[model samples]
Target chain A: MPGVLDLVGIFVFAVSGALAAVQKRLDVVGMVVLAEITALGGGILRDLVIGAVPPVAFTSVSYVVVPLLASALVFFWHPHFTRIMPAVMLFDAAGLGLFCVTGAIKALDYHLSPLHAVLLGVITAVGGGILRDMMSGQIPSVLYDRQLYALPALVGATVATALWQQPQLHGVFVSAGSALLAFGLRVAAMRWNWRTPRARGVGD
Target chain B: MPGVLDLVGIFVFAVSGALAAVQKRLDVVGMVVLAEITALGGGILRDLVIGAVPPVAFTSVSYVVVPLLASALVFFWHPHFTRIMPAVMLFDAAGLGLFCVTGAIKALDYHLSPLHAVLLGVITAVGGGILRDMMSGQIPSVLYDRQLYALPALVGATVATALWQQPQLHGVFVSAGSALLAFGLRVAAMRWNWRTPRARGVGD
Candidate 1:
């Protein structure tokens, strides 16, 4: 079930890229490249760290084709995606949460400490988004000095890791709770315009 | 002395990428991105693997500017770069060798095992070139059915790892010898068309 929901997260991220591409007035090739990077870059980074060759997305036929098709659809038909932006957000939150958990698991698999695992989880969740922004010549999300997107993933994954000793209790509930928590935090931040205090100084 | 060589390597790589950009007919923006990535990508990958943040390239102003200037030069003057192609290849080999040594030393600094450090060195040597190839939609050198490029880095760094265990030999000739071996191997391979035999049958 958790694995299935990860697909939804990938789709959500793809839609975000497609929208960004449209807004940028990009060609079809540009739209596909952005969508693939946004959806796949994080997992690729995570897997590479753990020494997973080809990464799962590269080997998995479903993961490879789905994003491309979605990009094409969005490229040709924007009206449909316009109505479903909210749904994409929900699923994307779920993806962020699930990917965060997966990152921690992979890091721990590499024998990293809890703190290190938590950091890796945060990176895995947000790395793709940052890459997408960089390729598009926009400021990365992390550079914006935004509130809690990465921090919440870090917290949620650490919490899950804390509870990981109960092997039987580890599957579905942890995934759901993490997804919900990340979603809630993101929604609250969006509504309230919450932000981390910027590094402030006058002109140097 | 080697610090200067490393920067020279960075310039060679940046120029190699910029020249590829010209050959590929990329725009100025594309050329800059390719050059910077070729110059910085391998080190960034090495740092991330060792759990270092921001990567050295981000923090180093000279590292950043040299690649940008290289790309700009290539964009404006196609004829000069073409004439200097042979010199660039020699420098590119030297740079590849230097990156391998630096990567191995860093991995050792992070307390990785000799085996892992050698692997890291190979990655550092070949990773940027392969990534540059991938972004340009070409087959990566690592995936090429060709002479030992990355493999020699693996071998040379392994020798460095063993030689460094001799307290008297640490940091003197061992490092330089390994780098020279890798560079010499590359030059030999290019000159003689030396190659690893294909593992699979060549395509019909």
Candidate 2:
């Protein structure tokens, strides 16, 4: 069940990635690469740190196929889909929540500390977006004054860790609840235009 | 003494990186970014994996100053330089040798096993180039038919390991000689156009 949801997270993240590529006006190849990384990047980092086998890129056909399809959609249908950013943003938030919970669970399975698992979960949620921004020549929005992006993942992972502490509580409720926490926080942040304050030490 | 050599290695590698950017007709900022990554990339990877705090990027002004100077060279005077490709190749090889040897020593200092140290050394040598290629949408040359690039690092690291097996043979000779072996083999491979053979099963 977790694995299936993880795939869904990857698929929607890829669609968001293709949307970013379209916004940036990249070539088809760049669009595919961006989408792949956005979908699989966090998972890959989590795997490498845990010394997992083959990497998801080689281990799962869905990982590749889903991103390719997403890329194709954005490339061929951008004219019709440009106004769908709101829907894409919503799905992206859901994907972030899904990846954060899954990544934390995976880290715990590897016998990492709860703290480390939470960190990994947060990385799994935000690392791909960071990488995407870096590749596309933008300051990672995570570093910008954007809304509470990474914070949502951190909060979600923390809740997941609390669930993990109770052996009986480790079920669909924890996953669903944690994901909702993240998605709701992010949507609120966006709607309210919440942002982190900048360091005032430097001048323009 | 070795630190000085590493600094020189950074300078040369930065030159190569800046030249690569120039060849691709990128602007100044791109040249600087590529140059900085080429110069400090291997060490950065090494530090990160070792759980070393304040990765070289965070602490060293030399790492910053040298790459900027290299980029300036390419930006201001590349038009006057001829046979840029060979210069880039030679410096790249030199940087590879320096990184391979230094990385092995660092791994040993961290008390890793011989095989593990050697693996780290190889990663330190080629990992940056692999990343740079990925960002630029190019297949890594090392993954292709290119001759024994990583193999040289393995051999050098192995030699250092053997030296460690006997306490009597220590100090500069063991380290420098191992480094020499790596450099010589890599240069020979480059000069001879050596390559891994392709095709498998029934030959086409």
Candidate 3:
């Protein structure tokens, strides 16, 4: 079910956040806080914009528990965890894909414009990571000129949203296809060193 | 009216955010985004947690426009704005006082516990600045061990929430008095260089 996939996504994001904490040398409390934020921040932002009260992350104990568990795991064995960074990034890409489709659907359900819904989907995919980076005192990776993160999310969300408007397409199929597209694109971008052009004379 | 005062507070916060953007050498778009976030981030967080739908920041045109205007003003003449930084900080403290009381009252109205209401109050006062700092790639001033920013907000919010629970006190008086107390405390802290104790052996 979509709910189960969402949890999986949350878990992956939480692990990434915990790793970021390890890198920053933050306290145990900081690790847990960062994990929670990285897992739930985007969903919370999406729900708030679309008027979903007591956001799913807030209302569901399972959502809170999963991220905390991820944090605890990383806290106890971060060295081992860091060794699996490549695997984590792949899962993070899947989460990004799933969130974009789901977030777009949710926004449309709330009667937002197609453009707005797409934007919200991208936000739901990238907002958490942005918050995580900012909390760790770094410029968000999404803002980096060389990062191709948000673009793929935007593409996947657009595809899903468009598919959603087609009467013949099943909802689950639409979501699955969108997720796969985004995940594959992200993986490709990583493998190929895809980069965005920086503003002229901006930085080295 | 309280609404008018809230706008003033927002304007001051937006100016501060714009100044931060100027320092960061962000483009006009960045300045506008930071301004909007800094002015409205706290209220948006408070509203989302309290289940206030379609946060006022998203709904109101003035809320959006005021910050954009502030960003424009600062983008063009940052030198003048920077010279008035002290005056802006004083107003920012007052705004913090007002927001803490208002945010607490709103949370209580939504049936949150006193403790949660007070926490929301402090968040509403400081969350914007924290977001602004993070967006600009800096550790939040609130997280600094020696900063006394949030404590005064906590105190004011607690006072307001307690007064709200009492049937005898006039609501307007309670709000005004709470704001005054917080404003006085913040001003005094600034004047005296009041410091909070850091964890032993933490970085200086």
Most TM-score-accurate candidate: 3
Q: What is the interface RMSD of candidate 2, in Å?
A: 12.0
Candidate that would win on lDDT: 3
lDDT by residue (A2-78, candidate 2, tens digit) is 77877778878888777778889898988999999989999887776655656676798988898998888888897
What would the per-residue lDDT of candidate 1 be over residues B1-204, giving only the tens digit for each residue? 877887898999999887776666555545665787798888889888887644566456677778988876776675687898888888988987888888888888888988888888888888888867766656776786577777677767787777766777878477889898889888888899778766578642
* TM-score of every candidate relative to the true structure: 0.57, 0.57, 0.63
Clashing residue pairs, backbone N/CA/C < 3 A, model 3:
none
DockQ versus reference, model 2: 0.04
Regions of candidate 1 where Cα sits further than 4 Å from its true position: A1-204, B200-204
lDDT of 3 by residue, B83-173 (tens): 8888988999989999999999989989999999999999999999998887888778789847678999999999999888886884688
Candidate 2, position A116, lDDT = 67
Measured against the native two-chain assembly using Cα atoms, what DockQ does each of the candidate structures obtain, in the order listed?
A: 0.04, 0.04, 0.17
- Interface RMSD of each candidate, angstroms, one decimal: 13.7, 12.0, 4.8
Q: For model 1, how many clashes?
A: 0
lDDT of candidate 1 over A91-152, digit per residue (tens) = 77767877887777676666665555665677678878877877786645553334556666
Model 1 chain B poorest ten-residue lDDT run: B24-33
**TM-score preference between candidates 2 and 3, better one:** 3
Candidate 3, which segments miss by more than 4 Å at Cα?
A1-44, A48-105, A111-122, A135-137, A143-204, B145-147, B168-170, B199-204
Candidate 3: residue B106 lDDT (0-100): 88
**Compared with the true structure, what per-residue lDDT tens digits does model 2 show for residues B74-193?**
667776443576766676677778788778778877888878788888877877776555444456667885587877777877887768667677687887888788888888888887
